[model samples]
Target: MRNITVEEFRASCAAAQQLEIVERKGMGHPDSICDAVMDNISVRLSEEYLQEFGEILHHNIDKCLLVAGEVTGIFGGGMVTHPMLLVIGDRATFSAEGKDIDVNSIAVDTAGRWFDENLRFVEPEFLDYQVELKPGSAELTDIFRRKEKMLGSNDTSAAVGYAPLSFTEKMVLDTEKYLNSPDFKEKYPESGEDIKVMGVRKDSDLDLTVAMPVVDRFLDSEEHYFRVKEDLTDAINTFIADYVEENKVSMDVTFSLNNLDMPGRGMNGIYTTVTGTSAEDADCGQVGRGNRVNGIIPLNRPVSSEAAAGKNPVSHVGKIYNALSHRIADRIYTAVPDVEEAYVWLLSDIGAPIDRPKVAAAQIIMKKGSVESVQDEVTEVIDRELENIGEFTMELARGMVPLY
Candidate 1:
């Protein structure tokens, strides 16, 4: 608590600014796949550790690589000549008390399970697996065995988070979610899962460019593809209009789908894939290269480079502090009427208790009051979140929180 500090935020919020940009990679994006799969693997590994050892042993399993596969597609269907390779590499508690943990089996199995759940068309049979997990260093492993009430921090790391998504950020996120939603997919079955939303807002007008690849199996010809594309575009426009009016946003939005189109170029320029994901052939993915913990990649705001997914949920400050900071910032903005926006930063020292960070700071953009007026409320928010660190870690362990 001594390290906690709250102050007036001097910088202008991105929402109030004139020019802003935001991007959200859908769950089927190669990078998102890596992040989600590895994170799910960590969760499964944590559960196994809990069931076997009565506690989660030390591990940091964030490293992952997704190698692209070979495929050829025509107007009707596609063939996968080679499967995508998923290389999961990281540290884990392999042996404890002379008993070995089946880390590789858990990692490979979780990756398959994740693919089965997230991507509608992609299957584990289409993926190649490689697990490179090894036991963590003794120094880091000993942190979990400490006599302290809480597990000591695994590494000296810093994480920052901010509250209140910007208008462009929300629009990008919402657009991707809408396109990938089951209802939308049921109506437009050709749409691929590897969707990306890019939003550019200048003043009140916003331009949204979406990349949604179509599954080749659903298309009969180029003409049919164009017709479906037009229908999808019109449908998205209708959704955006409803979204704008429902949210009471005065901003004018223009939406575009799949900018890469050359009608006469055969299938050379068309964004079509075999599976619902580009991972079948077009692209590759890696952990931490996708979305941030908050889900949207905010380019204008302060961001932490540390990736939360796949990290040990117990003592990895990278995962815990990044998520907790957002929770703290959101709580402060919601609880204090005078606060317009809030940003929280947390820095940890190795071997220190997870609840007590070396620097727990909050920056508030006040609407009507000075720093002293809402200091107690803001500090209480941070203190309360830190005090409940155990419950928060359990949620992370159980995969209840979103890391990407």
Candidate 2:
């Protein structure tokens, strides 16, 4: 039997607050790009390992870096003066029983496929010569030798998650999804996936700042760039207006698109890039630099710093516990009708069984009344979740859930 504890405490819910801020970096953002690439590689490696070795071997390919390339462009077209560089770092089991697994080939191919499938302007050929893989350090690789079958915790870490998202949080998350949705992409073909949605709530008013990259190939001139910006702004505000009205939330809403425009250059000076992402010429990226496990950065709320992507799903508490915490909170929040918000914290000791966490604390804010009424039910849910956490590895390997 696993020993886990759940407790309820008093705390104000974000929805009841007067001010809030939330941020989400979309899939094409450089840091998110790095995250997606590493995640894909890890998932692929896990699949291959399971097929050959009967289970995933120890691997943590989380330390990935994206070095920006040089490019220059007009409204209609651009050329890659220097190719973007991707470095795949961290340790993995590349060979076993004298049989070799081509880890480099797996990583490079995954990078190409991810870019080609995810980013509209980036072609796989452009990245073929630029991606490089570095082998894992001997010291870190030694850590995997201790556990082969039922894996133990890789590190002692804490993870936090919450549920029943606030109005602003939903707005921020939805905005990013809406922009990246196929329907929105079809309507605004010029828009790139490198979208960032920032939300601020002051009193009853909500303000949103969205940064979307415009593909140079889609814009013919400065006039067309401005037109595309206008269309996107209109589409987003329209969506916000509908959402606010449907939710019956009496709030004022405003939308701003890339305010970094120069005074004279206008919309052309906004966040346009050659390859539909700032990574082409301006920005660099690293894994874990963007969004948390919940996909939103709530500046005023409690959050864990653990980067869930690329960590070994079998035993890394940083990845499994974070996902478990979120699922637990969501389950409790859904089961308890009066619970306005639910927050869960989980801690693990290195080499310990994952099902038996060191600490499992839950905090809930009721809409009206005390936790005594729902305490037992919430505890049951947490216990059940912890017992079933072992199944999460397969879920992750199958890509049923996102680590970040």
Candidate 3:
């Protein structure tokens, strides 16, 4: 059988515009018309409206079409406004403006019920939000950008409704959990199945739990794309807000991660104690009396012997260190109060008689919860801990050093 020309079909279509034409196999179909209209709308629709309808399509496409009838009484009937073309076999061919477009047939179930049951358009409320991350904060910005990448991927399904968490943000929490656990493997047996956790050790800062949402796996369709996009956006925003809150504690304090042993005046000798004092044989003649205080010092105090040696105005005064400690304390206090116990450590070179006493140390302070209230106690302790050292101030200080 020879194929009929589109012109002939159009002439026939014009003759029986109202005829309940029996849709023929390999002939133009109604669904094909709808599909074409939908595709055109998707591409030409304003981004604003696209987002709006896209969201609706994500969860309610069926209702959008069919539900309109319930309230308006204007669908599926003689008004000819909401056109319903007949379907035959698995193909629906229709002629429009002398051109033929074929659409794959929808199933009876989909055509009769599901297709139009979910696309009801309703008056909706719109909400607006502005991101609050600092503009120049690279880490926060990077995290945000990463989220955008994940959300904007071609996977429309994940892009549509899925959201993901940042690897960096999640790492911090995972590190905390792992460090606090007595037997991480036992506590988290599934660790064996995690390819990322192979060699993790105790007290390590490495965050083995970092993961980004794999939106690629589900981006096969428009519906999934919308779903993933919503989810990814929400996840990123939530994580950022929490991170910012935790780090806000150290806003005013600064800490140094570098060596802190040099006096402003000159290089002091090794921080060794000498029994003999100045020309006068004073009671300070203890043999083991080395000026260099060798061990750890409280992070709240100056740790360099040079500080005490030159009485260098700021020597051993704990100005910077105390400021840092207080900042941490402030954050923790604000976030979590009533910490029953806290531990802090500092390393120092107390004095300088010997050639060199390197001043380097880490603070390891722990505090017990002081309050009887459960939520209050947990929050208070966390706040205090965050205030003390959670902010990246120590990291920020290196870049701000004066150019010598």
Candidate 4:
């Protein structure tokens, strides 16, 4: 202590940290706004209402929650007014009968912040809002009426869980934790380079494949999963732009690999088909099968539509879904490899800007490996399924349901 000097003491002082203002916009659709309002009111009002009446208006209350999910559009809700406030994750504060209540500040099941730095898995666009309760306008009946009009349905039960691996599912489970863990990232880096090798068994009878960009080096689960996925996409796009040459095949490379352990199980027989027309051909032989056929299924599933009046549907599905599934599988392939029994599915719908084409859905299932084979086996199969998205597209362009 006696030997300490001014410069030495100055060096030992802790550095100051800057506060970050994480801003989010509002979902513009009335359905989304209504859902946010209902979810906020649920926990805050449920027990309080139950205490006054033998049972709360549970049915009406439940509808509010469902309507919130149907909203698909969002817009900027100005800036977040309060930057320093800490809004707990699950449990939110709300007003009832002109009185504000903090029901169980320590509610472990619902309250507390979601400790993730990146919340993309929740598709924050669907959840974040700056709602101000209108005077005399917070009644449950009003919300129901508004939702029915905006969502175009009072029966929304059928709309729930129709697909797999939605952003919402990613939030409510431990998958987010596994994705954000450094160990997970270190083991499954986006770039294939610097791969953490897991010894493969020669006797393993599963088609396990991992697809994504390979990094020059490896990093692990220190960051969130969606964040990693986004970063990986950006890096790969940059690589393609810089390294890929013109004319020789400037391929937009997406990785998908398939293997069949139980090749004779008939499970391997499920194939994707695409239907499309050449801008020049009125009648072509490739009606159901796409030109770029991979795996075993080469036959095109004929889908008579504007996009494929004389073209093939199978080939179209193969290219689009194959790419989409590979990318989608890359997201959850590690956590749940055996996707078949895990309820593996992918739902792709169309959106605006028809020329650019967006991935309306890309999802998969994951369960405990003990009940299934290699997690990658299911991952590979899903990738194979996606290779036939064009079949679905042709049907959509023709106003027909492609697949259930």
Best prediction by TM-score: 1
Candidate 2 vs 4: which has more TM-score: 2
Which ranking of candidates, highest TM-score first? 1, 2, 4, 3
Residue 138 of model 2 has an lDDT of 63
Tell me, by lDDT, which candidate is best.
1
lDDT of predicted model 2: 0.82
32 Cα displacement, candidate 4 (Å): 13
Error of 2 at 220 (Å): 2.5
TM-score, every prediction: 0.98, 0.94, 0.14, 0.22
Query: Which regions of candidate 2 deviate over 4 angstroms?
Result: 1-3, 128-150, 266-268
Better by TM-score, candidate 3 or 2 = 2
* lDDT scores in order: 0.89, 0.82, 0.22, 0.25
Query: Candidate 2 lDDT, tens digit per residue, 1-404?
Result: 44555555655688778899999999888899888888888899999988887777778878888988888877687788888888888777888767788988898888889898888888764563343445565654555566554566778999988997888998998899999988999898888888899999998889999898787888777777777788888898899989898888988989899888653574446667778788887888899889888788889788888878887788788888878888899999999778888998999987777787888878888877778788888888898888777687779776778765
Model 4 lDDT per residue over 1-404, tens place: 01100100111101111111111111211222222233333433445544543222222221221112221111111122221111212212244446554433422122122212222122223233222222222342233233221211111110001123221121112222332346645654432211111111122111112232222113222233234455644543443344334323323333212121223332122110110001011111112222111111111111111111111111222222433333333433444444321222222222211112222222332233342344334444344433444344334223232110
Arranged by lDDT with the best first, the candidates are 1, 2, 4, 3
lDDT score for residue 26 of model 1: 97
- Which residue runs of candidate 4 sit more than 4 Å off their true CA positions? 1-112, 115-129, 135-178, 181-404
Once model 4 is optimally superposed onto the true structure by TM-score, how far is the C-alpha of residue 288 displaced, in angstroms?
Answer: 34
Residue pairs with backbone overlap in model 1: none
lDDT of 2 at 239: 95
User: Which model, 1 or 2, shows the larger TM-score?
Assistant: 1
What are the per-residue Cα lDDT tens digits for candidate 3 across 76-160?
1112122222221211112222543222222222333322332111111110111111112233223223323111111111000
